[model samples]
Each structure stands twice: as C-alpha cells, then as structure tokens.
Target chain A: MTTTEAPAPVRTAPGGPPAAVRAVRRWGFLLRRLGFYAAAAAAAIVLNFLLPRLMPGDPSSAIVEELQRVSGQQVPPETLESIRAIFGDPDQNLGEQFLAYLGQLARFDLGVSVVNFPVPVSELVLQALPWTLLLVGTTTVLAFVLGTGLGVIAGWKAGSRLDSILTPLTAFLSSVPYFWVALLALWVFGFVLGWFPLSGGYDANLAEGFNLPFLASVMHYGALPAATIVFSAFGGWLLGMRNMTVTTVREDYVLLAQAKGLSRGRVILRYAARNAMLPSFTGFAMALGGVIGGALLTETVFSYPGIGYLLFESLNKRDYPMMQGVFLIVTLATLLANLLADSLYVVLDPRIREQG
Target chain B: MVTQIMSDTDHDDAGTTAARGADGDVLRVTGLTVEYVTDGDPVRACADVTFTLRRGEILGVAGESGSGKSTLITALTRLQRPPAVTTAGSIVFQPRDGGAAVDLVTASPRALRALRWTSLSIVLQSAMDALNPVMRLGAQFADALRTHDRSLGNDAAWARAAELLATVGISGDRARSYPHELSGGMRQRASIALALACGPELVVMDEPTTAVDVVMQRQILAQVLRLRRTLGFAVVFVTHDLSLLLELADRIAIMYAGRIVELGTASELYDDPRHPYTRGLRDSFPPLRAPLRRLTGIPGTPPDLRRPPSGCPFHPRCAARFEGCDTHLPELVTKGGHAVACRLHDPTQRPQPAPGTSTGGAR
Candidate 1:
C-alpha cells in the first residue's frame, strides 16, 4: 500500500507590532462603531419631525380645544386669537410646521409640558430619570447576577434535584404576568403586611437632607417597587440563563475541560458557565435599555415619581411634548443598550473580535 | 492475566508492565463489550472486542462510522455517556509506574479521573470544538497540568505548557494564542500536546487526523510517530482508512458489526487475510502500488448491531459462505499470536454445497 508523506511546513509571514499598538488599533475599531450610532441618532431625529406631520389633526387646534374643555368655558374670540398667535398660525402649511419643529429640535427646545402648566418637557423628564434609574437599574443588575449564577449551577447539574426544582418554578414564574405579580406584592408587602410604605418617594415627615434617616426613608418607600420589579423580572432572567447554560454545558470544549481533569468546579465555572453566560449578557443589556421605562403600572400604583409614572401622567393629559421627550430618551437608551451588547460580543468571544 | 512475556523487565518499564513485550506491547484489551440503552433497548455497540498495543506501536482499528471503533476507544477511556453501557470488558491499561495492570472499565470514577492525562488520555475527533474558544492554548495546557498536579504554579505551568507545545513542533509563542487564531492543523497539534502534557503511557486517538487536510493529516501522524519514539508512549490509533492504518499501525484490528473479525500484524494482514471480510476490506482499499487501479467498495453496509444476524455478523457480506454458517457462530480462535473468528479456518469445519446448488450430496 502507498502512503502519503508528510508535507513541507509553510513558513509563516513575519508579523510586526507590540501589544501597545494592537491596543490602539482595537480602540480605533470601537470609535468606528460609535460613528455608526451617531448616524442612527440623526436619522431618529429626522423621523420625529416627519412623524407628527403624518398625523391627521393640527396639534395647535387640538391644544385650543383641550384648553376650552379644561376651563369649562368658551374663550372669547380675542383671547382665542391671542392663543393662536402665540402657538403658531393655524393656516400655515404642514411643511412649514415640520421645518419649524426641526428648528426647535436643533436648539434642544422640546417645549413645555401642557399638563404640568409651566415645566419644560426636558426638565420634567430629567427630574424623573434619576428615580427610574435607581429603581430599575439596581433591580436589573441584581436579577442578572443572581439569575446567571443559579442558571450556571442548574445547567451544570442538569436533571439533578436542583434543576428539577428550579426549572419548573422559574418557568411558572415566567408565565405569570408582571403586573399581576406587582399587584400581589403591593397588596402583601405594602398594604396587608405593612412592612414598607404604601406610596410616594419618601416618608411624609422626613426632612429633605443627606442624613441617615432621610436616606433610610427613601430606601423604605423604594423597597416595595424595587422588589416588584426584581421579582417579576427575575424569572425571565433565570429561565433564559438556565436554557443557555444547558446548551453551553454540552459544548465540546466543556467535555475537553473535563478530559483535561480540571477540578469539577473550575470546569463548570470557567468553561461551561462563562460560555453559557453569553446569551444572558445580551438579554441583560437589553433590559438595561428598558431601565428608563421602569415598570409603568407599578410606578403609577405606588405613586413613585419615576419616568414611567411621569410618562403615564403625560399620556393621560395629552402632554405631547413631554411624551415625545420620554419616548425619544427610551428609544435612544434601547438602541444604545443593543449597541453595547454587540460590542461586548467581540470582547467575550474571540471569534467575533477579528470578524466584527 | 499475567503473561510470562510481560513478567520480564526492561529499561522501557517506566510504567505498567501488563502487556510489555520486547516489541513494546503496552496495552491489552480482551472480551470488551459495550452496549447502550437507546429508546429503552440495549444496542450492542461493541461485542467481545480484543486487541493489544506495543510501546511506540500504532494499532489502527478500522471501521465505518457506526462500526463501534470510536465507541471502543471511548470505552477504553471510560468516556462513554449514560445509556451507552460498558456492560462487560477488561481494558487492562499497562501503567507507567510499572504497577499491576489496571482494568480501565472497572476503575472507580476517582481512579479514572486520576488516570486521565497521567496514564491514559484521548485525542478527540473534532479539532474545532476540542479547544476552548475563550481560553488561550497555554492556559488550556496549564489547566490540564494544574488539574493533575496542584503544586504547579501559574508560571511553572505556563513554562511546562510551552515546553509541551515545543515538543509537538509548535513554537512557544503560539501558546499565548487563542484557539480561534490558530489554523486547524495547529489546533489539532495543540490538542495533542495537551493530551501528552502529563506524558501518559498510552494515548487513545479517535480520528485525530480526520479533521485536517491530507497533507496536514500526514504532518500530524508524523508528529505523533516522532513523539511516540522520543517519549515511548503506546497508541491506540482509530481510523477508517485501512491504507493509512497499514502504513502507521504496527498491528491492525478489523472490526465488523461491533466485533473484531480479524487482528494481526499490519504486513501479515495486508499480505494474507484469512477471513473473507478481511479479504474484502483489503481488496476494497484503493491500491497505492497502481495509481490507476479502480477502488472497489464493499458491496453491503454493516449489519445493524441491534438486530445482528445469528451465525456471524459478516455472513451477509462474506464471499465464502457454507452450510452451518447460518446455524453456528464462529468463536475467536488463536493461530500463533494472531486471532480470527471464521469457520473456514477451523480444521474440523467442512465445506458445504456452493450457493444455488443442491445440498443433497454435501450434507
């Protein structure tokens, strides 16, 4: 029988560069990605201007009708004319209005919140954003860490007692509506149990200062809402991470790690869990985008002055400017979160680094 | 079973001496049977398979994809999963410490884990999935060494890993490279070096060179051969290519339907195959002596082991069929050192009427 002989080794092309140069190149790649995001943001602004024109009614006329209904009396012809003069010319073409809207956006003048009487939409949104971030951001991070850790354990020991117990429970929780769970938590933790405050940002009698009691009162009022968010959202994280971990545990690299005789814990944690966590990281990043939205019903039910509650109030009173501002911020946040997730894919998985 | 030949000591006795011969018999397996429960039915993957390997010997076990060759090697390492039951077997691994033969099939989980990479290790089939995409080659090697020997610090582990990579013909710098950065051949070599990090006595390779191109396959084979010579580790090389096996293996075992139909020295098996199935296999392989020669593929696929034929697994494919071949099963009988299970080779066995002829006079 004839045998094939070993082939001559092909000489590798010479490489030139130190670690510092490679680091700079990687940063350059990141900047190019940021450039794409800036382009998307510009397109979003243009769409915002064009979208209002597509609507059937004239926004200025709608405002006049709303003012008359709220006052419960028809305004005199002179006052109506004055109102029209300040708002805009009623007979102006839609093209002019659209161009004027674009001009306003260029100056960051989103206009006033009609429901709030005199507050600018941007100012109102900014006041509410920090509360939403505190409530949602903290809960999201906590859920992600707890859920991902449990998921890794469940997947590594799949079909064991731990998986048998956690899988069905998390699946049940995932199917339960978030609003229903929030309501239940409010009833149990807030009203019936009386362990936490029922509503508002802080205890009514607490002094507004950077003191321990004031901070404690703020945390107490925030507890039930935060718990509602965490409990309702944790199931999704757990189920998602568990599923991903199960898939990653079966990967050949994990088997190779086992073959290498690495400690069981190291194999599970480093090889299996780390790879399995990739999909969960994307989910977490997407959740981070929704932090600005918070939990609308929960926030409203608890009277928390977060962005979700403010957005709810704005929608009720037809506060178009405030609603638009909140929508733009939420949309931008979502897009940014997605972009971050994509960039992280390159960091977590080397296969994407070169291709990306 | 202690053999007289294995009892005598030599300078090569750096490990187990169960199957040690002057020619280097390092591992011996006998009566190995592996069955798996599939859909609540026990499917026999390997049945009564047996073979031996000398130090520095590559014993190629040739078969089609499902012929249980891969299953056999996996069973040798106890890597087979649940439902794939290793029902009955004795994989006597000759240890490197010159200790008594250890039965791999019956070893405890702890014992098996300890023996892995230190005494017997496996090089898996797929190179793409073998190395962790997240970890660098050096880290992976260090992980292997650190697993077995905890005293190895990070610096020491990395140094040892670099040395192992260098031994496998890879540069020390390549150790820092992640698996994705390396080529397919490089990945396979890195995997091989990882397997050999502890300098195991026997390395069980399952389709180790199949993933690479033909040229790369040769390079990997040559590297394995060179390492075997320098380290004196035995190998149980499993592959589907008989021609490659003929070149690489000192002895070869031909498996058919989960059983070893023929086992002999590579040259002897190639020159004169006693079993009809072995003959068919030898004839089917593309003849290298004549480049223009048409390769003949075997006529039928291997029989399903779940519902194997009663008399002989190879009866349907065998060219020489006789009466009683359908009624009696052949037992593996020894002729000198070689073993074959064919009724035609028996002295008392009588030839029956040829096919399509009357059986009145022959009976």
Candidate 2:
C-alpha cells in the first residue's frame, strides 16, 4: 500500500561527486601517499651515508690491519691507496665523497667490498637475501595468522579460562628476546637433547640447489631459528589484537550486528575482528617489508647464511662496502613498509579516506 | 484503571487519540525492574514499570536523562546485558500472527534471536554508529534478512533489501553507499529502513531523531507516522523531548526516577495531567502554537537510584508534595481512567487535590 505522498526531502544528496571528479580525487590521494614515501626514502638515504661516519674507526684502516693480519706484513702505502680507491676515495673530503657515493648509488653500484677483495657488495647482499627471506618471512606470516586467529577467539570470549591463561602466557613469552629464546631452545632441544643440527643453513653435504633433498635440509636446519622468531613476535600480535578485539566488541556497530540476529561468530568476525585487526595489519606489513633484514641474533646464534648472519661477519672484518649495501637495503625496506601501511590504513577505514 | 483514567477526561484536549486502540494488548510488562550492578553499588535503572501496548498503537516514553526510559525499553526487548541486569519482571509479548505469548525476560537466546528483526526490531539511539560503516547500507539490510532466513539466496536477499530501502523513500541506487557517504538525515532514514526490512509487528526507537536538526527531526517524525499508518505496526518511541512526543505519540507516559509516574492518552496527559512530575515535563516544553510564556525548568535533581529517597521519588521536586508524601511510598493507582502514581491521587487517602484540580490546567 505505497502512497503517492510528497517525496522525502533529500537532505544530504546521495551521490557526493561526479564519476570523473571522484576518479581524479582517488588518484590525487594515491599521489599524496607516494609523495610521502618518496620524501622519507630520500631522508633514509642521507642517513645511511652519515651513519658509518658516526662510527669511531676509519673504514680503510680496518682493511689495512686485516691485510697485515693475513699476510704477516705491513701493507705498503701504494697498496693502501689502491685498496682505498676500490672502497671509495679516503683522501677526498666527506662532502665530495658523499656526492661521489650518491652518484654511484644512482647508477646502482655499491662498489667492491674492502674485505671480500674483488666481490661486489651487490653480489654479497644478493647471496645472503634468500636465506633471510625464507626464514624470517615464513615465521612472521605463520605467527600473524596463528596469533590473530587465537586472539579473535580469546577476545570474543574474554572471561573464559582460555582468555585468562593465554593473555598472561603470551605476555611472558613476548617479554623475552628472540636470541635468548633461540639459545634456550638450543640448550633444551639442541645441546641437551642433540636432536637437531647446531649451526649453518643446510647440511654440509648438500649443495645449495632447488632440489627437494637440499630444500628439505634447508628447512630442517632453519627450524630452530624460525621457531625462535615466531615464538617471540607472535605474543605482541596476540596481545595487541586481543586488546583491540575486546575494545571493538563494545562498539555500537557490533552491537547492531548482534541485534540483527546474526550469529556470535559472524558478528565477531565481520564487525569486531575486522575493525580490531587494522592496527595489527600495519605491524604485519612492516614485518613483511623488513623480511630481507632477517632476525639478527636468531640467525647469529644458529650461524645461518642469512643477511643478519652475513652482517655479523662483515662487522667483524670491517667490510665497509658490504655494510653500506646491507644498511641501504634495510633503509629502503623500512621506507617501503611505511608506505604500504599508509595505503593499507586508507583502504581499511573509509572514514580516513573521507578525511584525507 | 479505566475509572482512574476516565476521571480526567473532563479536561482531555481531544477525544479520539490513543483511547480508540485499547483493544488486545500485544505486550504486557508487569513489575518489570532492571538494575545496574556497578562496582560501587547497584543502581535501580527502571523499577516496577507496568504498561501494555495495544496492537498498532504508538507508545511514547518520555523522561530526562538518567530517568530510565531507555533502560526500560532495552529491558523489555531482553537486550539488557551485564552490568544492567533484569532483576525482576515478566514481559509477555504476543506475536501479531497469533502465536503463543512469550515471556521475553526468560526467553532463550535462540528464541530471542528468532524474535529480533522479524517479530520485533529496534532503531537505536544514534543512527550514525548503529550502522556497519564498512558494509553498504543494502548489504547490511540483506545481512539482517539472510541471517534470519538462510533459505533465501544472495540475489533474492538483495532485491528484498532494495525494496525495503525504497519503502523508506531512499532510492535503490543509494544502496551501495556507506553510512559516512550519506548525510545525517539520510543515515537516520536508512536506520529506519533497516528496522522495517523484516516487516516487524513492533518497532522500538530510542531517540531516533535526537542528532538531527530541528527541521529534520519534525520531518523524520512525520515520515515515521505516515509509515506506521500504512504498515500497521506498534511503536514505543523514547525521547527526552516532550514537545516532539506530544505531536507524535498516541499515548504518553512520564517517568520520574525509575518508575513511570503518569500514563494517559496524549491529550489527557497534556491537558489533564495529575502527577507533579508530568506537569513539570509538560511545562518544560514551550507550546509552539500558544502565546509566548516564561518557561522554568524542573527545580531539583532526580533521586539517585543507588540511594533513593524514603518516600515518593519526586517529593524533593514535587510542588504540591504533602506531609505523607515524604514518608509514604505512592503506588500507581487509577483515578477515573488516568493512571498517576503520586500521593495526591492516592484514593481512600489524602484530601490533597490532584495536579489537575490543584495546579489548574497551567500552573
């Protein structure tokens, strides 16, 4: 029985903008995000150039001392000059050399490592990257999925024993550092039990190939370090998400969802969990971008052939070019992660998009 | 009760308002009480409230903030959760299609779920936050329908949602828009549409237009009244705005403290109010059509439910309070046909004049 009454006043017109204007606004929003990232990336590159200079020791002198240690003779001045050129000119002022380095960076050249002699810094970084990505990346993803899933259940059923027990237990685990946990795992499962290998990325007999046997051994040797990373990181995600979900459950929209006669499961998933998980998603994205950096001490304790372990080796030998290479990768990775999170937040919350 | 309500009909403004719909009671709430068990002490939010909703009748619940109108509505719907506990009461809700009456106070979750959005639905206080911001308005409507009736497929559910949106005068194309995309007025209308999607026999709205502009508020109420006429559903509309209720409600109930002190037909309550609290409520709203008059607010704070006063809850503010009013608890008793819970109307009792005779029509 619909009546032909006067039409309802369109107080706020339904559509806000024309299709073409809206499209332009969307593109402008994307450009703003990218612009922010571009500025941050430049700052990070400048910081990378200045950080090594902050160190007390000279970059070239370390190379000379190492040469003396290997050959049991003091290196000649001519030899030192040649070696300095390979790293970068030690004679030039810091400003000129920085300009030279920036020019070389633009050309995608990281120069030869002072310690590795003829090996390009790029080659050393590339060789160490896959190990870090495979180990740290897999563990981070596993922890996020597992932790967020458990957190959703725990927060929804907050007063239950599972919530009471899991919240504290995760808190305690998260307080301990990754390396300390790795060492503890080694003590219990490696040293005391002798159930797994103590060090290295793979079995000595296995060649580094994509063959099934070699890959299986790589995972086998990588297990302890991966577990250590996951064990420590998952707790933060779990706790953060648990608190978020608990707060989100009280939101009016979630209550509205329940009033709609939706099952508790759907209300928690669609309303509570989705909103709660936004902050956690940023953490996950950052972790993903830093995947190439690897868990530093976890890799060191296991002597795995990851970037973290390689950084440790380079640090000891005073490998200047290699250090710059790895630091630059880390800087770029962090900047990219921040950019990803910015875009991600806009997508997750339309309210933010409107404000922007 | 009939005798008590009828006594005040001499001054009743218009005759044919809510009195015509006093037939079969669709809901009977007897001795319904709800309390908040907070840390410091238990606060009685709504106490011993009793009312009946006739089929297709509109009931307006009026009170100031902290007066428990919202609590009573939430409790009636079995939506009160801890720490707001339903301490004592029985709410008998009968399905319009003639199923056995269900006690909402003791109904199982499954039973409540089945009743919500199908037999009875609610339009919450704030429409802005009541909607799922991430989902499209149509998607939310479809979700409500589909969740209740799983046999309906996605396409059918969507079509039903579009139709419901149209019923509220919102275009079908706006279905894809999110809540934030719509203005405040449209969002409120969308919430109304969501409540009506299932064709509920009763709809409970808690201050639905409080956040809108004054002009939009009147427009929304007009739209709602028109819809109710065609759809034939009962309403329990709660607001702190008594003027809005006078224009919109069929029956108006004035609450003081946690208890409803006066309940009558709109004209009887407006023109022949007997309870001091109801008079205070009526005087607070300036009559738009009447000549401009000085308006003074109710003088004192409402009794704290945690430690309520010994006698009549409104004695501290009651202009016509008597000696016995400070010591004797007044029961809601019928004087003629109107119901007033004030000591002035306590029959067999005080020789004090009721507000109708004592205060005249206007104090």
Candidate 3:
C-alpha cells in the first residue's frame, strides 16, 4: 500500500475571501439589530400615547378637583377655564390631541406636572436621578464583581467546607423578601439602635453649601438607604453567579482546561468563571434598567428624593405631567439598557459578530 | 479450558526471547475491576480486564455504548467519580526516563495532578463544549503550559503554544482566534494540540472523531496517526468502530458486558476471532471496498451490567453456547500472543457441540 505524504485540504462552497467578506457581513448584521431596536422603541412610544387615554378618569378633571380640595376655596370660572385651556380641554378631539402629544414628544417637551403645583416634571425627575444613580448603581456594580469572585471560589472547591458553608447562606439570603429585609433593617438600624437617621434625604441641620461638613452629613443620611439596597440585592447576584458557576464547571470546556494541566486557580478563574459570568451579565443589564426607576416602596418609606419617591407623590397628588415624565424616562432607559446588552454580546463573543 | 490450549501453544515456543522487546510497554493494566453503587446495588462496569499498551503504538478498545469501554479508560486516568468505584486492578505506567513504573489507581490526588498532562492526558468528544468561547486560543494554551512550567516567559510560552498548534496541523496565526471562530475540525485539532502541549507519554482519547463529519473524521484520524509517529507516545484509543481501528491500531481489544472477551493483534482479531462476541463485531462492519454491501448488526443487545448473567456475560447472545456454558465463567487464555476467553478448546473439558448445530457449522 502506498501512503501519501500529505492529504488535500477539505473544501466547501465558495463564501468569498475571509477578511473583507467577514467585515462586511458583521456590519450588515449590526444594521439589522439596530433596525429591530428602532422598531420596538417606536411601538413602545405609540403605546405610551395610547395608555393614559384608556385610564378610567379624565386626567384634566382629576387635576382640577384635587387643586380645589387642597385650597378649600371656590375658584372663579375664568381661572378654571384658563387652567383647562393650558392643560388641554378634555372635550378636544382625540385624534388631534394624539397628534399634538406626539409633536410634544418629538420636541422633548413633556409639559408640566398637574399634581405638583407649579413644578415642571422634567426638573423634578432630574433632581431625583442622581440620588438613585449613587445609591443603586454603586451597589449593583460592587455586587456583580464581589459575588462573581466568591462564586468562582465556591464552585471550584465544590463539596468542600467553603462551598458547604456558602451555598446554603446565599440560598437563604436570596429567598428573603427585599421589602421584609428592608423593614427589619430599618427597625434595627433606625428605631432600635438609633445608629442611623430613620428617614429623609439629607440632614435637616446642614446648610445648603458645598462644604465638607454638608457632604459628610449627606453621606451619613445615605448610609441606611444604601445599606438597605445592598443587603436586599446582594443575595440575588451571589446566588445567580454561584449557580451559573456550578453549571459552567460541568461544561466540557472546563474539563478540557483541567486536562490541559492548567493550575487549579487559573482553570477556575480564566476558564470556568468567565463563561459562568455570561448569564449573570445579561441579568445585571436588565437590573440596571430597573434600578434607574429606583425602588418605589423603599424610597417612599425613606422619604428619599429619588425618582421612585417622586413618582409615588405624583400619583397621590394626581400629578399627570410628573407621572408622564417619570414613565417616559423609565421606558427609554430600559430600552437603552437592553440595547447596550446586545452590543456587549458582540464584544464578548466574536461568534455573534462573525455569524453576521 | 481455554488456558489448556494456551499452555499447549506456549510449550511450542519455550525458547523465544521475551526481555529485549519488553521495555517499551508504557502502560500495563491487569485484572481491572470497576463497579458503581447505584440505588443501593453494586453494578459491575468492568471485570477482570487486562491489556498492555507499548510506547509508539496505538491500542484501540472497541465496544458499543454500554460496553464499559469509556469506564476502563477513565479508570486508567483516575477520572471516575464517587458513585463509580474502581474495586480492583492496577494501572502501571513506565516512566520515560526509565524510572520505576507508577501505579495510577492508588496514586494520591497531588501525585495524580503532577503526573497529568506531562505523563498522561485525555481528549474528550465534543469540540464545541471543549473550549472556552470567551478566551482567545493563545491565552488558553499559555494557561495550560504555565501550570506545569513556571520558568518559561510570556513570549516563550506563546511561542511554544504556536509550535504545538502547528504540530496539530493548525496555523500559528489561528492561535489568536477564539474557539467559536474556528471550524469544528479546527477546534478538535486545537484541543488535541492542547492535550499534547506538555509532551505526555500516554494520551487517552475517547471518541474524538465521533462528532465530526465523515471526511473530517478521516482527516483527524490521519492527523492523530501522524502525531503518534512523530511524538512516539502510546495511545489508548476508544471508539465503537472496528473498521477504523484496522487502519489506525496495532492491537485491538473487544469488550462485552464490562469484560474483555478477546485481545489480539489487529489482523488476528479481524481475520480469526475466537470469541463469539468478537466474531459478531467483526461480522457487523461492512467491507470497505464493497460499498453496496449491507451492514449486519449484532443479534442482541449487551447484557445489563447491574444484573448480569450467572456464567459468561455474553452467553445469552452467543450462538455457540452448549449445555454447561451457563454454569461456569471462563478465564482468559493466551495462545500464540492472542488472548481469548472461551471453553471449547480445552482437552480436560468435554467438547460438547452447541444444542442445534454441529462443530463444522459453528465455524
């Protein structure tokens, strides 16, 4: 028998040259994804316009009646007519009003808050935005990194004493309801021990100057709320990351890495941990959108000047403008967060980019 | 009974030299028994299995899915978990520097870790799941090399990895590509390259080509043979295909119901199988040259190892069974370098023909 020196390379259907062809394919795919996002955003905006109309009561009449109840005085007919004209007469044609609302959205003018007297919805929302960002954003990022690191250690040494200790603790913490945990924390840290202030945004005694003392008081006031946010949310991240790491450890690639004689630490971190992070990464992005809207009940309980507290107040006062403003911001933020995640998918996994 | 026939044959070659060619045996496994404690019952997966693999030779272990072929290889590497127990047996590996052979079965975890990759390695089945999609291939390779050898610099580690990739028929440039960027064949080749990065003396491959296309399978097999020639490492090749083994392996062992029924040179097992199970496997593969011929499957499924037959495990599926076949288990007997486990060839035991057939019809 004759043994050939080299075998011929396998060939398949022509798909053009590799480099230039793959680049063009990638851009084409990204364009398609962008188109899908644009379509979805348009649909959401349309739904936003239609939603308020479907509400049971007339928003204009509700605003007027609420104002009268607060003032405890009879308003002149001329003044009431002027308020109606400015807010949009309830009797106007639905199609014309819808067109007018769309025009206002295009110009970035969400109009005024009907519930909060004389306060523009945009100004109120912006004021609350920074607080939520500082509280939840910092905690979420910290939780992701710390939880993932711990999870890698736990999963790699699975069935050992460390894993045995951590697994059940994380499970218990994850099962505890966030609100229940917050209430318990408030009772202990606030009412019982008096280590932290029970409620409110900043210390009432601090002067309105950008001084070190004022900043310190602000941080002091933030301590309880920030702790509550981290305590309630940290468990979810830890449990998610730990479970994912366990599953990733069983994957064939991880076994292959171990068989390659990679050091135990390197195998756990570079191979197992990175792959395990994929599922948790997507979850974290979704959580980012929710965080922007802030924790509604938590903020209400604390009397914090975050978007959630603002939304609660606006709902109680029948503040239509403030409510519409907050909802629009939330919708946009969620869509943008999802868009960021999809783009991240391309960066983290080149296969998605190549498949384009 | 078969032992008598073997001793009779051994007497004819008493003066042959055995020592000069004996040093090349890299791994020798004898009487290996493995069982699993399943739902409070011990299920035997391997029993009294014996085989030897020499350096620079490929030994193919052929069997169906439930034949305990994978368990045998996994046991050799000490990769089996708790429920699966290695009850008895010794897996001895002859060191490359002529040191004392180490028994793998009883080695400590630390000793096993040190011996792995440099002395022994394994290649798994699926290429897709056998690579970290998030990491660049170069970093993955360097991670493996860095584990055992700390003296090598970053550049040198990468250089060595690229060289190893070339050895597996992949280009050095492909080292920078992630696993997902590579084709299925390329990914398998990369995995094989990683297995050989530390220059292991023995590599256990379990169905490495099972997931690839037919053409890619042949390419991979050819590449493996070529690497074996250059590296001179011993291999324990496990697969379900007997025909492919004919071209790649020097020796072949057939397993049935968690036991080695026959062991011989590739040619001997293919041309003159003595065990009924081996004969069935041989008859099942269609001749390569006759493409249109119908492939014949074995008549019955393998016995469930949890509650195996009393005597020979293959007796239920064997066409050559006689009256007393169910009463006794046969010991493996060596004859002219081939080992077979059967009772018909002994002079001490009465040679009763099978119930419905004559001796001539059996052959």
- The sequence of per-residue lDDT tens digits that candidate 3 reaches over residues B1-363 is 001111122222211112324467787676789999778679889997777778877989999999999888779888776678999867777777876666787776676677888889988878878888888888878877877898878888889889988887788877777776777888888888988888899999988998889998998898899998889888889999998888888888888888887888899987788887777787787777644555556688878887899888877877777766787787777777787777764435536544555222223
- Which one wins on DockQ? 2
- Look at candidate 3 and tell me the lDDT of residue A177: 80
The per-model lDDT (C-alpha) reads 0.76, 0.79, 0.76
Runs of candidate 2 with Cα error greater than 4 angstroms are A1-14, A46-87, A90-108, B1-23, B39-41, B335-337, B352-362
lDDT (10s digit) by residue, model 2, range B1-363: 001111223222211122433236677667788999989878999988887788888999999898999898788777776789999867777777657677788787888888888878888889988887787787898889998888999888888887877877777777877787788888888899898888888899999999999887877898899999999889999999888888899888888888888888899888877887888887787898888777777898877788998889888887777677888888877545578887666656665545435444446
Q: For model 1, what is the error of residue B217's alpha carbon versus the real structure, in angstroms, after optimal superposition?
A: 1.4
Per-residue lDDT of A4 in model 1: 84
What's the CA RMSD of model 2 in angstroms?
Answer: 7.3
Residue pairs in collision within model 1: B14-B96, B15-B95, B15-B96, B15-B97, B15-B98, B16-B95, B16-B96, B24-B54, B24-B55, B25-B54
Looking at candidate 1 chain A, the ten consecutive residues that score lowest on lDDT are A8-17
CA lDDT, candidate 2, residue A191: 85
Candidate 3 clash pair list: A115-A319
Models, CA RMSD each: 6.9, 7.3, 7.3
**Residue runs of model 3 more than 4 Å from their true location after superposition:** A1-17, A42-110, A113-117, A145-173, A207-220, A354-356, B1-22, B151-163, B289-297, B345-362
**Candidate 3 local lDDT, A1-356, one digit each (tens):** 45875432223122213666657767877787788888888887777676766677675566667667766656557545534433455687777776766666676666555555445566788889988887767777776777777777777667779889987888888688877877888899889999888887787787966898888877877788877777667767777777888888888888777666666777787788878888888888888878888888778777878888989998887676677778888888888877788788777666677553
The candidate that achieves the highest lDDT relative to the unseen native structure: 2
Tell me the TM-score of model 3. 0.84
